[model samples]
Target: MSSEAPDPLQHIGAALFRPLGVEGVYARTALYEDLVERLTAFISRQRDRSAEILRFPPLMSREQLEKSGYLKSFPNLLGCVCALQGTEAEIRAAAERYEEGADWTRALAPADLVLSPAACYPVYPLVARRGAVPPDGLLFDVAADCFRREPSRSLDRLQSFRMREFVRIGPPEEILAFRQHWMERAQRLAAQLALPCRLDAASDPFFGRVGQVMAVSQLQQSLKFELLIPYYAGAKPTACMSFNYHRDQFGVIWGLKDEAGATAHTGCVAFGMDRLAVALFCVHGLELARWPGSVRAALAL
Candidate 1:
């Protein structure tokens, strides 16, 4: 027998994902989809019943993205929708150029929509439109198919993925308390899945020189945390879950206020559904029958 060890990453790719000829984009296998469904159900059972559940499409208004400051903070990562404009003849000429192996995308113009970068982004605007928040504030369970421009072969770094977020909007104290509660709860959930993980202070992948300052500020203020799980032996751990405290940033931009007329503080606990499934398959064998009984029971798989 060969002395080389089995490549875990290769095994995972073959078992869980079907490549779509793109580096980071993939079509999940049935086994993977089943696992994701079970995981979603398990997570849903843990959510606050009072939270309003909302599902958003992958595309969001470009105007909303600009107002949210994402365009400024992560310009490189944002994916804008574009289309060929002008008369039918112009469009046909543009298409003909592509058939002759010339640049065709140059004729494209920006559309009104852009890919959503996060699940919780649209919630703020919707809530703000409803006027002042109640004294108890608002809790939302939101999910979206999000996209980013960065593409790579790294198993955990997907270009397009699903994000599930539990968002809390209220006073600063309440937001802080909510983050703390989820911080602890996430650890327990990891244990229930029998995955080795750690909670670490983290920062967003902000862009440019000014973003460096913003990242430092975020770390100093303890604004972000991630639940990291090792996916392969030699590689660094992957972040499967993130906890973020947005302070009053979203409130200020969207004009969201609490019953007392103060800008609402916002925080969210986000689960990387694809990354979590990969982690599960990495820790436990790909075979569902081989997984721990407790974990199977927890997910009711």
Candidate 2:
């Protein structure tokens, strides 16, 4: 027998993901889905019970996205919905061009919606519509099928993935405290899963020269942190979770305010569901039954 170890990423791809002939997109196996469900349940249990649970579709209003400043900050990663417009003849022409292997997508125009880039993006607008937040603040558990335009062959970097976030909005002090609490809690959660990990200050993939400044500011302010775990041998660790402090950015755009009439500060603990599952499989081997007893018990698998 060969002395080399089995490739965990390859094993996961074969057993868990069915590729759709697209980089970063796959149809997941039942086993994978089951694992995700367990993860979701476990993570949900960690949230404050008073949190309002909200689930959103994969699409959000394009206008809202523009308003949220994602367009300016991460335009390269944004995916907009587009469709053939004009008369039936125009639509037929576009379809014919597509069949002819021409650039048919040029005929399509931007629709009113865009694929949601993050699970928490839609929550701000919804909460703003509900009027001012209560004095003690608000907590929300939100989940969605999120999308990004970046395509990679890496199994852990899916272009279309599920994200779950626990969002907090209120006074700056409370928001900061909430992020700190989750930052510590995330480490414990990772330990329970028996995954080797590290926490590091991180920055978003902002776009262009202006974005470079913003990214530096984000890091200097300690506004973003990521919990990274190894997804493959010899490769840099992948970020499986993020803690972000928006610091009135979303509040100002969405008109969210505290009961005292000040703009609310916002922060979220985001779980990259697919990435986390990949980390677990990478660290624990392909068989769930053979995983560490503590991890199995923690996930209740």
Candidate 3:
């Protein structure tokens, strides 16, 4: 007899996304679409500031990634592009081995690109090409389909997810203020949605002992914060939003300087669109109509 327990979230109708024979990749239903649309609309209205909007591709240059310092911190989660690199006969043999349930990826060679890990990563280098930032600084509304190697059954944690980020790049004081404003605004946004949430100092899920040290230092410096919401039964809340302050790291890496020739600081507020939608469902149940009137009006759903 099989002893595996059933997934507790299997019965979450309408709002639940179904995995497409993969551990983390999911197919969103109409209910999920409704949630994302409303969420996007609300963000657009609340974010009334002027900024450059950019939608980046899912894959980014591997060289750019290396320069971004992502490989140094998150080598485990990096998804490099690999493709079959052999003649017809070798490809046929590889296909047969794959059908026989053998390790077929051995024939693959790394490509020049890697799946993009964050929405704001690619923007830094591009901005650097334009030379020093202006006195007013730069604000970007960026969105991307990000990828990671995490494989989990939990609905909140996925290998592929959408991230919507409002990134600020400029002098220390301006960018810092931008992040602080969002931190406060994010809490109010959560309250408006009626989602029970809290802001907690956090760190990235770095790899290995060295990574642990980095994580600790990050927390100590208060460089990261997350908006956490209770999403599942008998479990701690999941982080649906992250606010990061990358002080001069990206600026130095990409040669992004302020008008005064000092390295520019960067800060971003990222929204986990999928996770936020699921949190709303978990908190209010699958029936959107039954949700609080204020919440419904806020989302305009």
Clash pairs of candidate 2? none
lDDT of 3 at 226: 97
How far is 262's C-alpha from truth in model 1 (Å)?
0.9
Cand. 2 TM to true fold? 0.94
lDDT of 2: 0.92
Kindly list the per-residue Cα lDDT of model 1 for residues 1-301, writing each as its tens digit: 9998766599788888998999889998999999999999999999998999999999999999999999999999999999999999999999999999999999999999999999999999999999998888889999999999889987898999999999999888999999999999999999999999999999999998999999999999999999999986666999999999999999999999977789999999999999999899988978899899999999997
- Write down the lDDT of every candidate, Cα atoms only: 0.94, 0.92, 0.90
Write model 2 residue lDDT over 1-301, tens digit each, in one string.
9998765468678898998998898999999999999999899889898999999999999999999999999999999999899999999999999789999988989999999999999999999899988998899999999999989977877899999999999999999999999999999999999988899999999999999999999999999999999876677999999999999998899888877789999999999999999888888888899999999999898
| TM-score winner, 2 or 3 | 2
Model 1, which residues run further than 4 Å from truth?
Answer: 1-7
Using all chains and alpha carbons, the TM-scores for the candidates as numbered come to 0.96, 0.94, 0.93
On the 0 to 100 scale, the lDDT of residue 295 in model 1 is 99
Which structure among the candidates has the greatest lDDT? 1
Worst lDDT run of 10 residues, candidate 3, spans: 7-16
Cand. 1 TM to true fold: 0.96
